[model samples]
Target: MNNNEHLTKRRGMTAEDLLRLRSVRDPHYAPDGTRVVFVEKSIDEENQYRSHLYMWTKDGAVRPWTFGPWRDTKPRFSPNGETIAFLSDRSGRTQLWLLPTDGGEARQLTFFKNGVRDYVWSPDGTFLIALTTLGDDETIEDREEPEKAEVKRADLKPRVVERLYYKSDAAGFLDGKRAVLARIDALSGKIEALTGREEEIGSFAISPNGRTLAFVANRNEDPDTTFTRDIILLDLEKKTEMNLTNGCGTFASLGWSPDGMKLAAIGHDLAYLGATIHRLYVFELERQTKRVLTADWDAHLGDAMVGDTHADAKSPGPIWASDGSGLYVTASERGRVNVYFVSLDGPIAPVVEGDFHLYGFTVHPNGRQAVAAISSPTSIGDLYAVSLADGTKTRLTRANEALENEVVFADAKPFTYQSTDGWEIQGWIMKPPELGEGEKAPLVVEIHGGPHAMYGFTFFHEWQLLASRGYAVLFTNPRGSHGYGQSFVNAVRGDYGGMDYEDIMAGVNAALNRFDFIDKERLGVTGGSYGGFMTNWIVGHTDRFKAAVTQRSISNWLSFSGVSDIGYFFTKWEIGCDVWEDAERLWHHSPLKYVQNIRTPLLILHSERDYRCPIEQAEQLFIALKRLGRETKLVRFPDANHDLSRTGSPALRLERLRHIVGWFDHYLKGPFG
Candidate 1:
């Protein structure tokens, strides 16, 4: 063999050969703003899943900070920059740990016996706030005691319901206990229970003086905004609470000034109909007054949600300057959220712009430096630093060289499809680069979760792999997908699988009709969670596809309400009714209701540790498929969750891609791979 042939041999010619590959996500900046920290995951020669934390000198000098077989994630620097806290399961249970920046043995902090899911340090750097299910032995036993019981001072007066979307794939009848917040001292190591209310705490922050905490919570908010939450200010010393935003809608993003005199939040554009605006409001804390930052400018609502819950792709809506000179918020043009600076009192200007989505930016106390997670539709997120004044950006991490090495598919051909009733739907076509002998390639119709979520131009690892392997992949943002206006996003809120099914089918039809290379005889469908439910619904509705894979999907809405978390809220907000009141709606929407109609060879992929969608949903589907005497196989991923495809153990994530590719290859692309 020639030298070039030997070089090609050394290189990975097939996708399977690309084992020494990894991807970076959730890039966070250190407190000093001079360095960056991110998680790197890769498979070894033996294909073992390995992950480690790596640091970069803002100029891009990258190296590992931790070394071991165990996984490490969620690294956050203390405000003082002396310690970094993160979650690790090295001790067999995911727990919080503190480590010195100079790097040595990371000392484990929390030992609750079970595990901890989320944690954050207070602004004063003296305390740490953590959230974990207080279902501990002591707590559970305490609940068992009748002494804790109290009269219902105020009844919940739960409302009735009447729609399909009411029953979530995760929580069916939707009645489960909610999570609460707890606090711990960073130095003293003392712990305290902050709230005993059975309501979910969304996001929170510490006031400048560190005496009060503001969080978007459902502690005592209105019942109608179950899908939403209100901002609550809890005075720590006084132990008093005040509800700020009232019971409006869901609030996901917020920013606080250096002095804590003002607060900015990104939320509903309730001022106008068909307008999806993320209104940034500045509330004077003491005066109790609110002022709109973009009061003069036309609001930017980036998605197809009710009143634009989609953030501006350009900015994340607001991170304040250390000097309190201005605020940084994700600004958007269409489908892009770029980090941009807006003066506190002047026109909101773009310090950053382009077709990219941004996140995890930290502003320097000096105001000269900032680091953000930056990525475009064609690229994966890596660490980047930008000058807040000039908006000059420097890429700091080369997380993935796989995309550059392999001719991974990225560009999508945009097209729209019309439903049976003439509703125009958007879809994308991704084709392989190598087409030989005018052969028709197999097709895989992939669906996205978050019936309200938009499937847009974001980079997807599995989709790229599928396209690279010679399948014409078709995906779309149907009526319920975001990035369009609110009317479109909420279109499926009450109907879910009904019109939404037709919308997706129309896209598949469009792909088959518009693209001559698609082989109709060799077609497959797959999706996760909501997509899973839709896939089950699709199979029962029609026998068009030869095979299907449904991952983390809901088979029965009625069962989901109780089995899944957030059951109480899930049934009400989306469906507008309780399971009993809308029994027919739940039945009509369930994929199991028509399981007998499923003839396509099906595969059920689920993670046992998935709390968001729960593994039981997958179990039910697998059982139903087996009982029907249909061709089906179940791939159970242990210790993984609903976000498995995107952020699970690297080896398992690749395994997921492998199984997905293997299934379609078996049914669609002739199985040789």
Candidate 2:
């Protein structure tokens, strides 16, 4: 049936519909701008996500380029536009694969034992630069062992912890492996190590002339203690390297200018530490000088819109214009992520502005056009052809057209209200599309993870699912959220449960006052990470919420200061004190201290492998509530990390949604459910 006819039979969106949703991301334009390639990811019957490459031409025709059950992502056209290179795990490990534009079977390019992490093509397209990890004692020349005997599961050696940054949320425990750079011949597939396994490489970019390489890394004696990310310049011919930034500040998303005379990056010094806004910087190669392009721009430089539907979104850094006039970048401002143009002289202008999130994009070689992956409240990301001169965007791909036709999504209505100290807070409310007139509906206050991240116009599946289930979903970008100026984004620091808490409660009040259809008495609250901390704080401080769910949360600041992967430095940076420096203050900020006051039925959801907040936080809260004879339950997800809500297994994500919705139905809806 045609989409027009299918729309007439539209049904309410369901949690299970997540499996049918396809996420389009990382659009890269061919050198000539005649074609664009992007990755389309969807869940298969096995509940595993399969990402395949899809190609779109200037004629508006879109077709699948690679049919792979495994993930095939980061498609980049060669400089000559002859072949497209991407990373794939179809070969057991993620390796670089190349597919000819003229038509041929894709060929694997790298055979590293651990597989490639990231790669970029050379300016001349003769070679490629790739990043791979190596053990402390392992050399780049070491070959993979052949047919090694499998050790018994119980015989595995215990992991000895040594470094402060020993484990990460999604990456698990570190094995003393450092990310190193390697050069691979495009044709012969020969690989040679360019950097040793001493320090881990962060982000790297090849010079336009193919003569130099600029990479971000902290080479200090104790890199763990400092947040300094120095840009190092490597001379390909001389085999010499020099620190470009000279330990000035933390920087990332490095890009070389077209003339190869300047390097553009996004970062900031520890002016605000963890809450620092990311600014654009251009370094003159010859003059050895750095210029901050967005020094006057108040909003954060990169995309900070929080959503769960996208994966591997490209960093919208400074994409140098072909004529060397300026560069294009995405910035978060007022609950929207849009592309902007920053000139060499310092003037910054918007290139793409709308109520949609530009998650990823690639500029055309001609510099006049770009292919962007844009999503909105009603759309689940699609490719668009954007004109750089006039900010005109033309829709190129309707990836989720079928899903849109089959299901009805609630429209997110944006609103602003005054919070603590008369600070303006931005928020959105999504009411069920089928809400009867004058009928009150249960309100679910959804809090975003990153206190630094903003809840914007992006298509959020979980919000839509809640709205479809006859719940009014209210989400707000309180203080400490990006997109609202630097002062606002940094306001939550050192005041975790203070003003931030007031801002959220004020948002809930604002929603109740503005929306007559919302039933304030049957209110529910849920959030993860920093949001989870806020959830715990909210329930402990007030009995207003009827139900609450905290995911991968923080219950005790003192315990979190040592247990989390980023606990040590993050505690000092955000809380303004370490465990030893001010234990009493940490305890005061902890939600566990006020657990006795929590009367709301709380549901604790956490991932077993979540090293960011650590599952211990949930354990502490669950045990405390259970000991107090309070109504609480703990739901643990096995083999998942802190990113379980966004990037977890398809089946597990659905299960999580079920648990959340079911809990709210029982507590908030009660007999009506």
Candidate 3:
């Protein structure tokens, strides 16, 4: 009975172990850095999710360069490393394909009409540049009729809404189709229209003497009532255009400098609007001059770490360093998301610091190496390599290493305390892997949803399925999160439910005075979208949670400043006011104006196309908690959005993790019969 206790038995993590976790994502490299590629994803036994394209190799050989059951993704590579391109959906829609590295057979470039929402590779490998979406009288020769570009009907046309940024909990109703930027013909796929501009472009780069491109848009004059992104540049062979942040601020990931005379990016200047932070600027394309490079660095540069498994992870923005010597970027800090480097004369450092979650990277054309992707609190993501001269790493893709050799996850820990005005915060916890000696358990808490995103060390399958059912999870980062800087994320913008609900109840009394097997009367709580408006403002201001769920929430900032979709400038930028400038200061920062002082037992869950907190804010908190009878419920999901628990629909993200572990095991384990 001892082959090391049968190879270390294992068990815990379930909710169908999120269909055996995989994810990986956007690695790239291969312009002769000895190949890398990436993508992975997973889920199928009919619960669907798929995504392919692999590769790896620096002799640690990995393989699978695209397989069927389509959904391949952003690969890239090509500047004569002989083709890779990517973004697939195997022809039924998301186009731009390619493949080739020494072999053959992977063609289909871009038929347009609606597919390909991003591309790139044009440092002189005969162009590719993409990003699609057309209609204002569409054309790319009306997508050359592949049966009218694979017809799919169901338009039912009636969205005539005139933009105040019409719909997007990830592309839902923006049907006036704008995005643009074309070019193609990477060996005759033909395409053309590179920026017919009407403002939608956002994030682009191209220039290493490929005659400039640079991008990021917002051509003002009602580009959806302004956040003015600017950047511009253009001139791909004298088509001429210039701007470069004249609209002054809110930029995006752009990069560019191998000697094309600088450009970097990642932005800000709405100075604490949606809780600002995002620094590192550097422009100078021949004296159009700009500089910031982390003006006295504070954190929040690219990957603001919040997890639910890195799905579609792509944010290695400002990478440069092949000889530009100063780029890399990934930032976030305090709860970790590392990879720093910066230096365009200023300093910055930390080329990959620790406690996990790097979330995508690339470099290595000998900038001494990088690859990355990472993830941790028990790895549900892979691809490593690293080094960049002494941080070391290696790993590379055991995808989920047989779901970590059959389950058992839990880890987290990390602490820190002081809340309200003493400030500090930053949390974590976890516990319960089958608790026993002095047994106690049951606790939950888990909030994250970008009160400007941060929760740290990645891999969170609903906090390891509530610490594998025995609960005790916790999670923190309060006071408007995002790696603790820019005034603690603009101190939760104008204080919604003030002091970020007392920094998440002082991180649940600092995890019940630093965990003594947690239990404090078996609590429970949840979150989603501003942590589901702070789990409906912590059960309408504390009954000390004996269960609550919330998801994709927000309960009435006066009908969420007119039905959400960034609710009229995110309710005047995070409740500073505006329903005609103070609908009683957004009902004194709403949670359905303290829903009759709720008494826990909630649930809610939402997402019938949540246009970001818009399942009518979970049907007005389940019809005002069923007209005050309380012990509420709700559910929803159909064609979900507001990313139903991160990139939804893999059987509704496993039935929203079994309705959040069956409503915290029916009111913290003891009722349900």
The residue-by-residue lDDT of candidate 1 on 258-305, one tens digit each, is: 888887777664432222445567778889987777655553432221
Task: State model 3's lDDT.
Answer: 0.82
Looking at model 2, residue 263 earns an lDDT score of 92
- Residue 279 C-alpha lDDT in model 2: 92
Which candidate order results from sorting by lDDT in descending order?
Answer: 2, 3, 1
TM-score of 1: 0.77
How far out, in Å, is residue 296 in model 2?
A: 0.8
The whole-model lDDT of each prediction reads 0.68, 0.89, 0.82
Candidate 3 lDDT over residue span 524-551, tens digit each: 8888888888889888888977888888
Given candidate 2, what's the lDDT at residue 132? 85
Pairwise TM-score winner, candidates 2 and 3 = 2
**Most TM-score-accurate candidate:** 2
lDDT at position 45, candidate 1: 61
Which pairs, if any, clash in model 3?
450-453, 528-532
Each candidate's TM vs. the true structure?
Answer: 0.77, 0.97, 0.34
lDDT of 2 at 437: 72
